[model samples]
Target: MLFKTLRWSFLFTIIGLAIAFLYDGVTGVTVTAILIVLEVSLSFDNAVVNAKVLNRMSEFWVKIFLTVGILIAVFGMRLLFPLVVVFVTAGLSPIEAWDLALEKGNPDTPGTYGYILNDAHPLIAAFGGMFLLMIFLDFVFDEDKEHHWLGPVERALSKAAAFPGVSVLVALVWLFVFSRIFSEESADMLLAGVFGIILYLAVNGLGDFFDGGLEDELDDEGERRASTGEVVKATGKAAFSLFLYLELLDASFSFDGVIGAFAITSDPIIIALGLGVGAFYVRSITIYLVHQGTLSEYVFLEHGAHWAIGALALLLFVSIGPHIPEVVTGLVGVAFILLALWSSINYNKKHRGEDHVVHV
Candidate 1:
């Protein structure tokens, strides 16, 4: 089984490499590998969150996610999303974007690394800032008693129109309108922000709906929960649906990563290789989460993932108005997740009455 799985991964990797080869030879290979690592690092939290949702999906859908979903993520999102963003934001025609990407004149060529970097900075900042804000608000306003802190402003906001989703929508609409009053560039940036919001809401809504249905089924103690096979089947179905949702979420998260990469290099091959390798690690991480039952074992893992998501959302919002460093954005998110993981470990130790004991 392990060999078979490895074989499939190998095949996919080769295919990815082949595509990269078609674009550029050695440079393509090297860049693609780098992108894979970058993508994987940036998306570790994504895999964990995905596992949480996938655990409730069906077997067949899980297979599809591992196959078809992976293809879309590696190719469609990593390769094409950047071009789309450039086209939309930079007002470059598709052919213009392609030519600019493939042109080999100089690394410092106009619309090359330097130009793309300059053009992409605002978008990157907008994405990062939005992600950060979402994180802060979520951490502050979380309703769970164990996580709550009382602050006057937070208290006021909490009491008055407490729906976070509504706040996000209102903010997005405001940004959209604000952009129109400003320049076209600002409008494009704001549109990206709106897209990010819509993407998050759509993915989360679908996941929640599916989760609710599964919960309902599990609650039915009669025919639905009758046997082990039945339970497994139900779990598998839920896992499949969840896997699909998770893949979509992963794609959403990749938006910034994909676009940001263009600032470094426009070579489609390099981007593919680098991001694809990163995706491999993400898949491994997701599998580890699933096998370890991290969500169940570490009580706060899910909470942390949710916090990370909220942080990412804020990061996206900030991306609209200000320039934020991608590295900082990524680090802040990772820090929150690590903190949550550490807290979960501590909670587990305490619950097991092993907190006082030194394991090592």
Candidate 2:
């Protein structure tokens, strides 16, 4: 099983690199590798979170996510989304956007597309701020309460094994608000907001819908020896859900990375390479977390991740005002997660006894 897993990982890596090479030769290969690493590193927390969600999904959806989902992630979001942003917001024609992206002979500075993105700092900041703020509020508000207004919706849908459609409503609200605020000149801002929300909802909803039922099936605890079966089931659910959550979480996390990468380079191939490389490391880290059961053993890691998410949301929301730096926003999240990890380790040491190291 381990060999098979390793082989598949290698295959995927080769394929990813091949795709990059086809797009831009040696430069593409090198850049894509970097992106994969950056995305993976920046998104380690995301994978842990995704595991929690994935354990709940059926095998079919999991396969779909790995296949079709990757395409959307690599191409739709990383490659196409930026172009769409430029066309809509910057008033650049599609051809112009394409030209800017493909412009050659400029070695020292970013291309026309990069310049456009730089000029659109306010817009990027808006997205980053809102994304960060959402993370912060989510942590602070503890919106997952069982008896809140959305509780009934959650429970009713829980039985049906679907996520509460609250994400759609949230997206709509985001569209309306941004549309009203940024629509005076063009509806691009509204369109962008809607697109972002829809992306969030689709990824989030599918994860919840698939994972909810598996968790439901694991509730019975009466028939098992050493209770090992029960523990495995419970842990499996937790791990899977965690993974799914992390995937969605990483998508959310990418809002800034995507924007930030534009600052460095505008070549779609280069951007994809750098981000994709990061994503690879993130996947590895998440697998490590799952295999090691870091969250389960540590206890406080989940709290930390949630807190970090909440902080990210707040930061994203604040970007609307255009004063915040993306680096600071990212650092805040990193600090929160690190602190949580430390606390969890300490807690485990105290509770599990000094001689015992908690393993997943």
* lDDT scores of the candidates, listed in order: 0.61, 0.56
lDDT winner? 1
Error of 1 at 151 (Å): 13
Model 2 regions lying over 4 Å from their true place: 1-37, 90-96, 104-111, 119-132, 143-249, 317-331, 353-360
Query: Against the hidden reference, what TM-scores do the models get?
Result: 0.70, 0.63
In angstroms, the error of model 2 at 231 is 7.9
Model 1 CA deviation exceeding 4 Å by range = 1-29, 87-96, 104-186, 206-244, 314-326, 353-360
Going through the candidates in the order shown, the clash numbers are: 46, 71
lDDT for each residue of candidate 1 in 44-114, tens digit (9 for 90 to 100)? 67877777656655666666767787788887877676667657656888888777666633445665632
Considering every candidate listed, which one attains the maximal TM-score?
A: 1
Q: Compose the digit string of candidate 2's lDDT tens values, residues 1-360.
A: 344434545666788788878888887787666556555544545665655445444455556556665666667667777788768766878888777777732323544666666556445544443443343333334444322222344234335323354434544575466546545522545544555555555544654564455445554452342265533232444335444554445566776677666544567667865676455455445445655666667665665665566555555544544545545665676676777778776666666755443332
Report lDDT (Cα) of residue 328, candidate 2.
Answer: 69
